[model samples]
Target: MGKTYLYLLIAVAFEVFGTSCLQASQQLTRLWPSLGIVVGFGGAFFFFMQVLKELPLGITYALWSGLGIILVSISGWVVFGQKLDLAALLGIALIIAGIAVINLFSISSPH
Candidate 1:
């Protein structure tokens, strides 16, 4: 279970990197950032597949996407100077709450 979580964390990190690179890619026009998208997403999917071996799809996807969204948003805000409005912050907070609930209470997920 700990190994599963490590895989999930790695997957999320790669996903966030991919998403960040996607923004930096500038519509796929830039060279390094565009290549980074491929490498990041590829690594993400590879590790995500490992995670899926131990966890259910629905729960895994929820956790994966939730963390990815939060990390990517932060990356955008900090690295790209993107704006995060009050509503967006509220939404992110809600996502955090949802993830907490899942980790805390959901039997389908490993505690």
Candidate 2:
């Protein structure tokens, strides 16, 4: 179960990295950043598959996508000078809370 969460975290990390690279890819015109997209997304899905082996798809995808959204938003701000207004910040906080609720209360979560 612990290992499953680890895999999920790794998957999220790779997904965040891939999305960052995607931004850097400049519409797929670059070479190295494009490669980073491939490797990062590939690694993300691989680890995600490992996670699915132990956890339900709904729970896994919720955490994966929720955290990915939050992290990618942060990356966009930090790496790309993007800004998040008040509503966006509120939405992100809500997403974090939702993931916490799922992990803390969901029966489908791995023990």
| Candidate 1, residue 66: lDDT | 99
Cα deviation of 29, candidate 1, in Å = 0.9
Model 1 regions more than 4 Å off: none
User: In every candidate, how many clashes are there?
Assistant: 0, 0
Predicted candidate 1, C-alpha RMSD: 0.7
Candidate 2, 1-111: lDDT as tens digits: 788889999999999999999999999999999999999999999999999899989999999999999999999999999999999999999999999999889887866
Over the stretch 5-104, how does candidate 1's per-residue lDDT look in tens digits? 9999999999999889988999999999999999999999999999999999999999999999999999998999999999999999999999999999
Q: Cα-based RMSD of the predictions, in order?
A: 0.7, 0.7
How many backbone overlaps does candidate 1 show? Answer: 0
Alpha carbon lDDT at 101, candidate 1? 97
